[model samples]
Target: MRAKLLIGRHARLPARLLLLAILLGSGPAGASSQPPRRFEDPLCHVVEWRTPPERIVSLSPSLTEILFAIGCDTTQVVGATRFCNFPPEARDVPRVGGIVDPSLEAVLLRKPDLVLVTRGNPLEFIESLVRLGIPVYGVETRGRLARILATIAEVGAVTGRETHARRLIERLQATLQDVRQRTATLAPERRPRVFFGELEGAHWTAGPGSYVHGLIEAAGGENIGSVAPSAWSPLSLETIIERDPEVYWGTFGEEGEAAARERVLSTLRNAAAWSQTSLGRRPRLFLAHADVLQRPGPRVIELLPELARYLHPELWSRDGQ
Candidate 1:
């Protein structure tokens, strides 16, 4: 089936213009001889299709979402993991498996022309698919919004839909820029200090390089745990008590309010010192979906306003008193 594209004729111009210019001049014969660079994809390890892939399979939810954004067509996607539930239409696709343990047999049976998976996926599964002569494209997002757009462009090139992909990338960039401008008036002091994670185990929170930390900053909040080197890290209860963030955030919706409360209590219980701190006394905790909070995709824009409201309720007010 053909993919549906919302981007119109104008979006197709840039790539066409470049091709015309290349033809008018002369094509570089040396360009084909260059070895594939680390960051450069359509890499030597993977085989690229001359024609668009009619059947596709996605291993990760984020990749699946990107595919749909490019406009998934019928006969295109035969299988996806249980976690790829964005855009709602993805639910209709067959569920092959989940993270860590993917169903290789199910993937093979679907006979997809191309399979998209990210770096975190199991090496063995990817190797097996490669051995079977299936085109497996591996995307490494590195938890940044820019990388997400880049991946979309790459996928578009691979699937012969570069025009649609370029437009989508530009629109996403413009939206992000607009948000930045809207929040430019914010002062450093106005930025609320926020902590996010589970109370159980090591008390994980997003750090400096994490996409969530970037989102927190973009939404006008300061992530209390953004100092760590890793994207997600474990923090001590004493450290949390010392920092004493103004707002608390976590993934607790599926469990409901009672369960959420229990989870928060478990963390507070572990951090007994936090009880003495002001933030602990009457914690301004909020629950959000794990995917929305974690996935670095289009839903980030939707989450921004929700975060802004929590960070600065005064700015986001009702129409009248």
Candidate 2:
């Protein structure tokens, strides 16, 4: 049977063994069959079986969102992390555990035919699942807008919905490319120097090798502190004063814009030299939802374009050019 065609059906072990034996008997001696796609990681491999997997479990919230986006049957998603709370429908799925530490007992009890997990899942947990003869599929995608789309396609291909996945990636790439073109119109001199702070207290900023650094550059702004080797690093007021960024971007989970602004300003103003920088005098502040921005998912296509408009109003047209 063509394995690709049977994407999401569940097959029992005994039946699969019987089918394998029959295929071996029918073939000429010493003949070899085509190998199933091997993902290299021991935890996730494509199993050639009598049937495909019907029940699925997702360990990461980001992956869960991607799976649902590819049109997976919600009822078939029997288990998910507690944080996998998007699409409203996910809330109804049984919570297996947190991302890093999942409840193996809960997962085993669900009797999932296929288990989906991302790169950072615990090795021990995956080993245990493997010992039980469970089929697990592991996916690792870099934190970029395109990778998110590729992940959609990858998941779709495995679940026999590659067509749907490809279409989704095409739409997403088009939107991002359009935004990139609009951003490119800005003259280098006109591009403002911007700083993206993850939190107020920590003074953490996204820098080199980070996906957001790419986002900031694509949006036609210079990331003031991205020269650092790490993607995220702590920034002191002295460093802020030295760079003198034109815009200060941050994510906050609080009520009232005035209160939030005051809190942020107070922290910066405490450092006398830093307060004198270009940002403190006339700052263009950008705020985003923490979960949406922090998690590397499909939302960045929607997130970055709006931020570009805010940072470089003159470059973009009245209809968000």
Candidate 3:
């Protein structure tokens, strides 16, 4: 499948405009081979640096996780968004407010040599930072699983840790291939129907072009929300009932496991329509660690096996034992 480019909510430019912008902003790949490095971002914008950045700030939690996974020095990572609390050590990094509404002043105060951003960040904010001579690179990691792995490579290359990045990619690729191989032979009729509840409120779910949909497909389950028009959309309770999903998965970010599970169960139990489905009767509801499942980082790989076990317990023999 072709990779989908995610430009975030703030700068939802048309594809033509986005391509033009990238063409105008960037030079040809491998424009030079000297001490100062130049690399193109997912948007095709060229980012040049005198050397690998020493003080980096990550505006997106996913990017923060990728940086840490690629083995970037923690001390050099001066700032991260408030939600970037993964890998344990990330908590020590200074917070820069929320992902979309990050404090520009706080970012500037860190005096980072490089600032990493993803979709949902305002383009104007990035431009302002550029004006102030701060190098900002946009890392797009949405849609397909391949795109997410590519983002890891991009981050590694930009940080001058290509070796580490390649190793991580290989590991991820191997795991994905193994999962695909194991689940590929299952007949369509055997594959369980799944509903991925992205948010607890209003019945938001993963749809056709979203990464979560990809995850569902990879784990040998059919995503009922794949019928939705957009990547993420709100489904009516009637629609969910009509599909009659066998499994329901939700994620919790800051909430404790017990609290998250209770909240998810409460939300489902209260919905009269949802309570009527097979998922409600047997309650195949499962809770995933929000940071692992929601963030488009290396940890997303961890979700595949968990989902497979949920959808195909007999194949696992003893719940992935």
Candidate 4:
């Protein structure tokens, strides 16, 4: 039942090093106090949005969604990357380009007062913008749940929506606590053995260091892919068959679970490949929205109950737990 955490893996900055230094102080019994007026980013640069920004740009879809969630609108968020298509309003923003290769010229044209980034944003891009006198702030939101919560608090301060951010964080905390309380009471052996990975086009999966891993554990399931070497990696079909997970689940881009169902069923039924194993006899599919499962943002909290319902339906069936 023990899994090793591979922190560094294939990232420019290791997940541990990418941790944000937000000022969302901790209170008694795992609660958060009021967010401070200022905080420090991963770059060790201090950030304080003394005046609410009139124009903002988001480098990632997750960041863009967070901006909108914290009371920011099209007027305030003037530009975002092409991949930011959530909340409908985001699609209306001017395209600054993709996350990895954004157009510097396009970013400059938007005349944003602030730019928000996630752990995946390039350090060089941030520095280039800073050199041009634009304030750039980032959040560490890859695999860590605590870091994601911290990001919500920090973004609220940046957008001057501290109350909104705190409320969201509190709701997220309450849900997490409820799930933890439920899972804690279950004996370890009783939890389901689960696998959460892409089975449509590829065999990619989340390892022990990923939020998916945390989610699987939180939902009372043991991640069969925990043996994978890194936070995100590919697993061979042979290995998956050997492990023979009791459940299979994943997401396909922004299309969500329903979009992924046919593809999954097709693959599992392909020439009776999956049926040859124990999984085919007792198939349990739990598809989720990629935006919630794969993307690291405030909305990932929404997956908590959805995943638990599939993993442990008995609790919900009896008392709606």
Candidate 5:
């Protein structure tokens, strides 16, 4: 089955050119013709604020990261999920609960004027917040990289930080373009096949239309898991062996980094076909902080080059350049 390609959160593109088009009201075909003034969320709700929101509750970790990245005052951010522990300062923010199961009581105690959520949050929870007259913005990061940028812009618009958001987007775009230029010329056959295992126990991997898949493509590697039907799916052990990817990359969370790395290495080494492929011989396995791959936020741009270097060391070598 051909995997359906989903738009990535930070896919490589002609940054300057795309930025110019977006700023000039001439973005990619089918995109909005003007810079957003009112925040329109994925749930199709229009959110407008007379003044910048001073008290905010961020239910999504990615949104929390975005709020901090775009210069939202930390003091005004009253509540964030426990997982929103990036920027170090975010750890200081009061935790509401887990991303998918935030506590309404805790969120209410924050007295937030605005709440930021993602599609993963329960619809009923969002509805309850709306029923209470709190302004809720539901951000979705499922398909395209553009949606991720749009989420940034929307948050900036509602929070009155449009300038900061625009600048951040430009910087991110520049970095994305740099990665693209370096890898764009690689021949298809030359690109290594890569498998991104999200979880070792179930053989869980990222497939077509996922942010990880986009990252793999941008880094000049073909994602072997792209045959799956959705953004994330499990691949059978037989399928993985059949693919025999040249490189194996995965994210380790909760489990301490050292243990996670050792566990993943041992699991791969024990596979029946471990002796038949590049991974079996050289074991080109890499483990990264889970959030870097899972969170669709500004830091993703920071990690893109690192992924590129891992996937194509020859291109990144000092002698090669």
Candidate 6:
């Protein structure tokens, strides 16, 4: 059966996402006068700040999105990578190269008092920034959902948006609970075997410890990549054929979702090897919003329910939900 088409339903941003101008238009809470307070990153680097940072640079797209989500935007977020395009305003921010090859010179030009990065960033690169006396904060981003929430709280604390962070966390946890509670009683036969993620003609599959692995399970589907070695691994084609995933779930980018979906379908249809699987015969292609589904950012809450519905429309039907 064709996977449920629930993409367009979530196209509209929730009211909370539209509070940027109202919440941050006047700028940070004017706490600059407060005495310096202690702050630290996941890497354990401490910096005493008198107030929320006025000028900040984000080295990763996930960090950039989190900053914008918690009412911190252009005025406070002075620089970001080219990939940080979201909320339609991040594009206006100056570019500081990429996570691995970020231009330190470009970052210095922004005169940022704080720079945000992820644990996935190169240690040497982070050290280089620190050696120049640039204060850096690195948050956890490459793990499970709990780590994502913790990162949001950390970003909010450092940016003085702790309240917004808590709200976002509550929503995510609620959605997670709702999905799991609703799907927990499914019969064994109801949970389909699924394969998620493919890159460069190989399976960059999600394994046991990964966020995507947990996501598929929470939505009541058995992840076929559970036996793979790590969170993300390129499984051999022979192993994929042996395991035989019935459903194929993939993520599409900002490029109009329709066109991207068709491209993926066409590629799979044209490939002979794909035609051998149950996914090819059944034609159950589950497409996910790449930014929301893959990026460990605040926007992920937008895709949570949609993903659950796609996997088990019987339990999460539109009107019923």
Best by lDDT: 3
* Model 5 backbone overlap count: 3
Residue 269, candidate 6: C-alpha displacement in angstroms: 3.9
Q: Report the C-alpha lDDT of model 3 over 91-153, residue by residue, as the tens digit.
A: 999998888888889999999988999898888888788778777889887877777898999
Question: By descending lDDT, how would the candidates be arranged?
Answer: 3, 6, 5, 4, 2, 1
lDDT string, candidate 1, 1-321, tens digits:
011111222235898645544543354532553322111233234434435788999888877777888887545877899988886898888987986788999898889888888877798888888888887877775566566677788777776678888888888777666556656789988887888875557778888877678778887888888766688889775677677777788885567767987778666646776666655777777677777766666666556667766776765564342
> For model 6, how does the per-residue alpha-carbon lDDT over 53-154 read when each residue is reduced to its tens digit?
899999988889888888887999999988888878999999989877888899999999998988656788888888889888888788876778888888
Candidate 3 segments exceeding 4 Å error = 1-35, 42-44, 198-201, 266-270, 318-321
Candidate 4 global lDDT: 0.76
What candidate 2 gets wrong by more than 4 Å, as runs, is 1-44, 47-52, 198-202, 235-237, 254-259, 318-321
For each candidate in turn, the TM-score is 0.79, 0.80, 0.83, 0.81, 0.83, 0.83
Positional deviation of residue 198's Cα in model 6 after best superposition, in angstroms: 1.7
| Model 2 RMSD, rounded to 1 decimal | 6.9
Q: Candidate 2: what lDDT?
A: 0.72
Q: Kindly give the stretch of ten consecutive residues in candidate 3 with the minimal lDDT sum.
A: 1-10
**Residue 136 shift from truth in candidate 3, angstroms:** 1.2
Residue pairs with clashing backbones, model 3: 8-120
lDDT of each residue in 238-315, candidate 5, tens digit only: 687788788888777888788987876776677656557677767777678888767888877677888898877877
Positional deviation of 238 in candidate 5, in angstroms? 2.2
lDDT against the true structure, each candidate? 0.71, 0.72, 0.80, 0.76, 0.78, 0.78
lDDT, candidate 5, residue 112? 92
lDDT of 4 at 175: 88
